[model samples]
Target: MNMLKYPTLLTALCVSTMLLAQKAKPVKQGNKSHTDVATVEYLPEFTREVPAESGSVFKIKNKRYNLEIRLWDQKKVRIVSTVPMGSDTDTLTNDELYKMSGVTLSAFGKRIDLASDEYPENRVAEVTNIQVQGLPAQPAKNRQDANGAEEIVVEGYKTTTKKQQANVGEVTVVGYKKGGTDSSGKTPSAFPNRPVKDEPASIYGTQNPQVADVVVTGYKSTWTRTSSTRRNMVVYIPRDCKLVVDNRYTDIVVNEDLDKAEFTLYRSNLGLRNVNELRVDASFYTMYAGNLGYADLKLASGSLTAGTIDNAQIESTGSEVEYEGGNTLFLKSKADRINVENVGSVGGYKEFGELRIGKLSQDLTLEGKSTHVKIRQITSEVTAIRISTQFADLRLPLKQLTGYDIDFKGDNSTVYSSFEKKEMNANAGIANSESLVAAGVTFGNKAPAAFHVKSDESAGKKTSFNITCNNCTVDFK
Candidate 1:
C-alpha cells in the first residue's frame, strides 16, 4: 500500500466534499423567470414573465376591448399608444387603455398612428399579412331608397389607395364583431313622443347594448430601415380584434432585403388558469418570426400535450426548461432529438431519443437504438429501467435502487460493465452481443432471484466467476 498517495486522496476528498456541499440547481443566464405558469408570453420583441393575477379586463370610452398585457408586479414598464380615429388623430392614455375590456374601432375608416418604447426600435410599425376573423355581424336587412332593393353585405372590400417605395398602402375590409354600443336600435317614440318612461325598463335590459357591425380595415404596410441599428416596432390591434397566432407569423424573420426590428404579440393572461389545452407549433424562423426561446412558451394548468416538434428544431444549446408541476410528459415526434432536464415526473411514451434526467419517478423504456440514455437519481421506492439499445451500456450512480429487470436483445450491440459496490437484486438477460464480457458479470453480495445468461459454445467466450448458490445452478455448454 502506497502511503504517499493517501495525502493526495485526502485533498481530493476535501475538495469534492466542499463541491457536493455547494451543489445547487443549474441556473442559466437570461432565462425568463416564471413565477406561475399562466403569466408567460412569447412575442417577437416582447419577452415578459408576469404574475397570474395581472391579467384583468377594463372598459375604454364605453368600448369593450381586451387589453392583453404582460405585467410584473415587482417591476415597472413604460406603455404608449398612438391611434388614428376617423379623419382626425387621437392618442389614448395607458390608464385609459387599461380600463377597456373589449373596444370596437371601425375598420371601414381609420389609420393607426402609433409609437411605443416598450418595443425595441422606439417606433411603431405596421404589420402586413394581417389576418382577422370573427368580426361583428352585418346589420339587419334595410330597404334601399332607389328601387326597394335589399342592400348587400360586402364579403371583404379591397381597394388600392397609395403606393410608395417598398410600402404599397391599401385598405382591405378585415373582420367584424358584435357587441359595443346601441347605434343599431334607436329609441322608439312612445305614442308620438307623448312621454318617456319615468324609470328604466325591466332588469334584463340593463345588459350591454348590441351594436350593428364592427369592421376592421387598414393599410397593412411595412417599414424599412435606413441605418444598421436594430429597429423596434409596435403593432396596434383594434381593442376588440383578438390577435390570432399562426405558424407563419409566429416567428421572427430577418433577411438582407428586410430586417426585423422587433416583434411581439400579447393576450389577456386569463387563460392561464382555465386553459386545459396546450398546443405547440414551432416550424419557422425569420427576422419577423423565429423560434421562441423557452422564455417564449405560455404556461397553463391544463393536462399538457405537445405536438411533433413544437418548432422545426428546438436548439437547446445552453437552455433548460423548469416546469412547476405536471403528471406526464409525452414525446410524440418521430426520431426526435429532445434534450430534457429537471422535470418532476414522466408518465407517457418515450420510445425514441436520449433522456437525461436529474431525477425520475417511474420506469423508462428504450426499445430502439438510443445511444446516450442516462439516469442520475431515482426518487421513488421502486425504479424499473429497461434498455433495448443495440449496444446497451448501463452507467448510473444511483443510491437506493431496490428492484430492476433488464433484458438485452441485440447482436454485437450490448456492452456490459458495472461499478456498483453492492450487488443489486435484479433479474437480467444478456443476449447476442457476441462478446465474452457478458459471461463475466459478477453478482456482488446479492444476486437476482432468477438469472439467465445463455450463449452457444461457438459464441461463448470466457467466464471469470462461478455460481455460489447451492440452490441456484449455472449450465455452461
Candidate 2:
C-alpha cells in the first residue's frame, strides 16, 4: 500500500509541473516582444479620451482572434479581423464580445494596440479590401437584375435629409444657436434688418443647441417669379453663425471685409454666403472667396477657389479646388486636382489625382494609390512629413534643407536628388525589388542639429520626413 501511494503522488506532481510549463511559455510575434497569454486573463476596458492621429494603426486581440483598426483620413476607420473559420464562432465569452464591439476604438490622437497572449501568430494580416466607417455616404448605385429590372442599392446604414427653400427675392438664413451668442452673452441677429426679439429662440435650449433657426426676409412684391433664376445680390451674415449652403446651379462669390463685419460677400450670381462656420455642397457651380474662415466644402464636378482659410475640410469627386493660405487642411478626393500655396498642417488621402502644393508650414501626410504630387518648399516649422504611396511619382523642389531629416524608401524605383552624395546613407536591394534603395539624409552644415534620418527603418519619437513608394520615382532638388 505504501509503494502504490508513492507512485500515485509522483504522477500527480509530474502532471502539475507540465501544466505550469505550458502556462509560462511565451509565443513570439513578428519583430515585437513576445507576450504570454496562456493564463487567459481579461484586460481592463480601454478609454480613448482623445482622438487618434490620422493614418495610425491599432490592434485588438482576444483568446482566438486578432483585429486591426486603421484610422483613415477624414475620420474614417477600417477594421479587419483574423480568426480561423468555425473557431470560437459561437458561444463567445464576455471578453471576446467586447473586443469585437469597436466601442473602445476611438477614431482620432495616437495609435492604440492591445493584445491577448492566448493567440500568437507572426503573420501580418493579408491586405484585403474592407469598408471604412464615417466616409461621406455615396450616392445610391443603380443596378439591373437578371429580370432586367432597375434597382437602386444604397451602401450606408444611416441617412439624413434636410431641405430649405427661399423665394426669388427673399433671403433665408439657417443658423445654429451655438454660434449666435458671443463671448459677451449676447444673442446677435442673423441678418442686418432682422431684430433680435423677432427672431425665434432655438428649440434646443442653451445647453447644446443642435437645433437651428430659419429666418426669412419679407416677400417682395416686385419679384414674383415661379422658376428660380440666378440673381445678382449682396448679403450680410452674422459673425458667429453656422451656415449651410446647398445649391445645384449657382455661381457664388465671397468678398473680403467690405464691411466692418467678420466676412462679407457680393454675389453677382445667385448663391448663399456669410455666417461664421460655412459648409457648402454644390454641383455644377463655381465659388470664389477672397478670405475665408473655417469651412467644410464638398463638390461634385465643379470648382472652388478661395484665398485663405483658418481650417478647411474639402471632399470632391471630379472637381478642382485652389486655395492660398490654410492653417489645417484635410482633403479627400478622387480624380480631382488640388492646388494650395501655403499650409500649416495638411494631410489627406487622394487617389488617381494630382496635388500641387507650394509650401508646408508644419507637416504634410499623404496615403493613397496612383497619385502625382508636387511640393515646392518645406518651412522650418515643419515637424514631420510622411508619404506612403504605390505607383506614384513625388517631386519636391526645396528652397533650403538646413532643418530637415529625410528618409526615402522605394521598391522597383529610383531616387534622384541634387544633394551632395556624402549626405546620403543608401542601401540597395531591399524587400521586393533588385533596384530597391533606402536613403537617409540629415540636413544642416554644423553637426546635424540632433536630427536623424531613417529609411526602411522605424522612426521612434523623432521628427522625420519619411517616404515609402513602390514602382515610382522620387525626385528632390
Off by more than 4 A, model 2: 1-245, 250-275, 419-463
lDDT of 2 by residue, 96-138 (tens): 5445433333332444333333212212111011122211223
Candidate with best lDDT: 2
lDDT of each: 0.28, 0.45
TM-score of every model versus the real structure: 0.32, 0.41
Encode model 1's per-residue lDDT on 1-477: one tens digit a residue.
665769988889888988865442221212211111111111222221111122221111211222233222332222222321122213544434323212132222222112221112112211112222211122212212211211112122222222222322222222221222223343322222011222222222333221111222222221211112122222232222222232111112112111111123221111221112222323222112222222223222212222221222222211222333233344322233344443443433333344565555554544444334465665444344544433223344334443232332233222232432112224322444343224434554333332333224553232211112222121111
Cα miss at 274, model 2 (Å)? Answer: 6.5
- Cα displacement (angstroms), candidate 1, residue 313, comes to 17
Q: Please, what's the RMSD in Å of model 1?
A: 24.6
Give lDDT for model 1. Answer: 0.28
